[model samples]
Target: MLSFESAGRGILCNDAETRPSIWCKGVQPALPLWLASHPDCTPYDPASADEARAILRSALQALYVDHQAGFYYLATHDDTCVDTGPLHRADAQGAIKGMYRLRFTPEVSTVSTASTNGNRKTPPQIRLCGAGKALQRVLHAARLLSQDWGIAAEVWSCPSYTRLAREGRAAARWNMLHPQSRPRRPHIARCLGDSTAPVIAVTGYAQHIAEQIAPFAPGRFVALGATPQRGTAYADFPGAPWITLIALKALVDEGALSAQTLEAALRTYALT
Candidate 1:
C-alpha cells in the first residue's frame, strides 16, 4: 500500500533539495506503462500523457462499483494543457523510481487545433482552483477528523497538493472554513478521503491506494478516481462496478462516458 508516512519530504525522487510533497497521485497510468515498455531509453518517451489520462478514465469505470448510486466522475483534464516534454524515472515494475524516466516514442498525439463542437452540453462541474488547494482541503479535513474515525492519511503523490501547505497556506480544515483563494488545476486525482469502511472504492492503478480505505479506518464514504482504456485486456480493474457514472450519462446526452451500454460491458469485464 502507498502510505503518506514516507511522504513528508517528497514523493518524486527528482524533487529539489528543498523537498516537496511528491503528491504522486495525479500521475496517469501511462507513466508507469512507458517505464515498463522501454528498458533502453534514457529519458523514456514522454508523449503519451493523453493515453495515460484516457487509461485512467477507463480504469475508474472498472474499479468503482456504484451499487445503485452514481459513482463520482472526475478530472477530465484538458490534454492540450499538459506539458509532456519532461520525463520521469521509474523502477523495473514501472513504479516511478527517480525524478526522470528516459524519453521514448510517444504513442499519444496532441489535440487538433481544428474546429469542432464548440459548446457546453453538460452541467457545469465544480472543482478547486488549484490542485494543491483541493488536496489541502480534502486531506486536511481527513486528518482533522482522523482520531474521530481512526483513519490515517497523508500526502502521497502530487506537486499540486504539496504547494498547498508550502505555498497555498491551506489549513487543516474542510472547504467550509478554509475556502480556497484560487481555482484548481485540471487533473483527476486531486485528493482522496476514506474511513474504516469501504466508504470510497477505487479501480485500476488507483485501487493500489486501497490501503487508505475503510475496514482500515472510518467514515461514511470517501473520494475516488481511476485510469482506463477501451479493451478489458489492457485496462479494467479488479472488483469495480461494470458500468461507470460517466459512460452511463454519455449515452443519453451523447457524451463519451455514457452509462447506457456500459452496464453490459461492465458485466462482461467483471465476468472475464
Candidate 2:
C-alpha cells in the first residue's frame, strides 16, 4: 500500500515526530535510488516544478519495485519559477546518488593550487558544496570568489544530506567492526579524499542539516545554512555574499589569506 501526500511546510511541521518514516527536504529534482535500502515511508518536499516531476516518477518506480506497505508523502512548494536554467540534470542525478563532487574547475587542476609558474603563483583553492536553490548561490559564490579574491572554488551539489550521513555512519560502523581490514570509506570521503582544502557545505535547511557531513569531511569543514536569528521565529538562508565570506574565512583559518584580507572582503560586501 503506497500512498503520497505533498505540502511545502510538511518537513517543518513534522520533522520532530517520532515515526517510522524517511524525510527528504528541499528541491530534489531527481531519483533517490537509495530508498530501496530502507522500508520506511518517505515524505519528500520539492520546491521546483522539475523537482515535482522527477520525484513523482522516481517515487512511482520505487513503489513498483518494493511492495512495502507504507505511505509516501510528496511535499511541494507553491513558488514556481521559469528560470530553471540553474538546475543541472547531471548534478541532480549525481547528488541523489550521493556523489559529492558535482562540478570542478578543470583549469585549476588541483584543490590546493599554490604551485608557482615561474614567478607567478596560482590561486588558493576550496570546495563549496550546496544543494537545491542553495547550489545556485554556491555557483555564484564560486564566481565571486574567483573574480573578487582570485580564489579557485569548486562547486558540489548535494541533494540528500540525510543519505550522505546515513552512508557515512554505516561506513564508520563497518570500519569499527573490522579493525584489521582496510577501512571502508563513505561516498563523501571517497569524493573529497584527494583534497586537503577546506570544505564548505551549505543548505537551504538549517545549518545542522549541512553539519551532518562534518564527521566524515576530510579536512576543515564549514557548514552553513538557514539559521534562525537570536529573537526571530524565522530562519535566514545564507546567500552568495555570506557564502563568499565564509569561504574567505576558511582560507584565513588555513593561513592562506591574511586577517586583513578577510576584513577587506567584509567591507567590500558591506558585511561590516
Candidate 3:
C-alpha cells in the first residue's frame, strides 16, 4: 500500500545536514555489520531483529508480488540507522530487492590535500552495486581508505545491477531527440558542474554490471570486481579495505580522478 512517492524517499527521512554522509537502502542489518569493521564506530546497536524482519517483509513482498522496485534510505547515528525513505522505486514487474546507505564515521576526515581557489567543494561519491553481503568488503574498504587517502568518499549501496542497467537504458531512450540525433543530454548523466569528484563503482560481481550502467552518469567511472584471475569467487572479506585503496590509486594514476585531489587527500593525512 505504499505510494510511489512515499516509497522513493521512505518515512522519517533525515535532512542533508542531519543525515549520515553514507547510508544503505535495502537491509537494516548492514549498518551494524559495517560498523563492526571500523572499531572507531563500534558499540553500535543496529535495528532490532523485529524491525529488520518488518523491513524485509515490506521490501520482499513488494518485489515478489507487487513488483515494487526502489532503494529505501536509512537514517543513521552513532547508535543506529533508522529507516527513513525509499531511494528509487518503480511500481511494476521486475522489482529487485536490497538497497542501503552507509555513513562515513564522523571522526574520519575525508578531505582533499589541495586548496580550492575560491571554488565550492564537493566530496567524491562511489556507487556500490550487488547484494548487501557482496558490497560489505568494498564498503569497509571505502570507509577506512578514504580517511588515509584524504578523500571523503560517499558510498551508495546498490542492490540491483539489473535494475540500474534497465534504468540507464530507459534513460538513454528518453534522452533521444530523434532516431539519428546524438544525445544532447542523457537523463542520468551526472553534471560535472555539480560535482567534480569521480564516481568509483565497486561490486563483487561481473565487471559488466558497472559497464552496463556507465552511460547514465557523467563523472569518471571506475569499476572493481572479479576478474579472470579471481574467477567468480567473491572477494575475501579481509582484503576488501586494501582492494578499495588499490582501485582508488588506479583511478588517480589513470588520470580518471584528479591527481590534485588524491595528493590533497594524502597530504591531509601526511601519507606523503
Candidate 4:
C-alpha cells in the first residue's frame, strides 16, 4: 500500500524541489487529506435533525466536487460541537465555483439577507474560518465565549485551501471582465466590508491554509497555528475544548472580543 511517509521520502530522493507529492493508498476521493490522516474521527456523523442531515449530505457532495475540481480540500480533524453539523454543501460548492459571497446579517440570523434593504447596518464583527480540527475548536470556543461576552462574531466553515489560493490568479489570466459579466463582490469581501473587526483564520496548516485566507480578511487579521518546531515524539488528542478556551482568551486579551462585554452579559443573565 502507498504510504504518505514513503511517498514523501521518494520525493526527497528525487529532485524534491521539482517533484510533486503523490496521493497514497490512504487518501480517498470521498475524504480530504486532513480527515484521511485522522483515523479516529467519524467526520460526517448522521445528524439528529433530518434537515441537518440533508444539508450535511450536500456538504459531502460539495467536498467531493471541490477537491475533484482542483479547488481547495480541507476538513475538520475531529468532531467537536456536534450540534453545529457540517459545512453547508451549497455554500462549499459556490465557494469552489468562485461565485460565493457572504453578506453580513444582523442578530445572528441564518436566513438569507438578500431581501433586506441595501442600507441596513450591523455592529463590527470578526469572521472566523475553521480550516482543520484545531482551528475548528478555536472557532467554536470563540463564538460561544463571544456570545456570553456580547461580542458580535461570525464563524465560517472554511475547508478550502485551494479556493483561497486561486482567489486572484484569475485576474492575471482573464484580464478585466466586461462590466456585465462581472459578478457581485465575493461573499468573503462583502462580509468584511469596512469593519475594523479582525478577520481570523485558524488551522493546523497555518502557513498553507491560514496564510492564504488572511488577505481576504476585512480589517486586522490573525493566523493561528503551530510554530516551526521539531516533530512530535508522540501523538495524542489534545482536549479540544481546553484548547479552544485558551485560544478565545487570547483573542479577548487582544481585544478581538471584549471581556467587559462578557461580564455584562453574565450580569444580565444572573439577574434574570
RMSD of each: 19.6, 7.6, 12.9, 11.5
Clashes of each: 55, 3, 26, 5
Candidate 2 global TM-score: 0.71
Better of 2 and 3 by lDDT: 2
Q: Which 10-residue span in candidate 1 carries the lowest summed lDDT?
A: 124-133
State the displacement of the C-alpha of residue 168, model 2, in Å, after optimal TM-score superposition: 0.5
Task: Say which candidate scores most in TM-score.
Answer: 2
Summarize candidate 3's per-residue lDDT along 1-272 as a digit string, tens digits.
Answer: 33354554232222221211223432232332332232222111112222334444565565556765543433222333323233333311111222334443323352443446754354444443333334456556666555554445555555444445554565567667466766544223432224535556654334554455565545556665444334532222224554455556656765656666566555544554
Encode model 4's per-residue lDDT on 1-272: one tens digit a residue. Answer: 12253332111111111101232322222233343233322122111132233434444465454432211112322234233443356654544432232232224332212224654344335555554344346455455445443345565544444444344334323435545565545445554567656655555442343565556565666665443333632222223344334434445666755675445544544522
- Candidate 3 residues lying further than 4 Å off, grouped into runs, are 1-100, 104-106, 110-130, 177-194, 228-238, 250-272
**Between 1 and 3, whose lDDT is larger?**
3
Candidate 4 residues lying further than 4 Å off, grouped into runs, are 1-83, 86-89, 92-124, 172-187, 190-194, 228-272
CA lDDT scores, all candidates in order: 0.27, 0.64, 0.42, 0.41
Off by over 4 Å in 1: 1-83, 87-169, 172-262, 267-272
Rank order by lDDT, top first?
A: 2, 3, 4, 1
- TM-score, one value per model: 0.21, 0.71, 0.47, 0.47
lDDT of 1 by residue, 1-272 (tens): 11134322111221111111134434545543332222221111111353234323333443453222212112322333224343333211121211112232212111211124743233211111112112223333233223222222232223211112222222223333646654432111223223212233332233333222222223233334333445432333322222222222222243322353455444544543
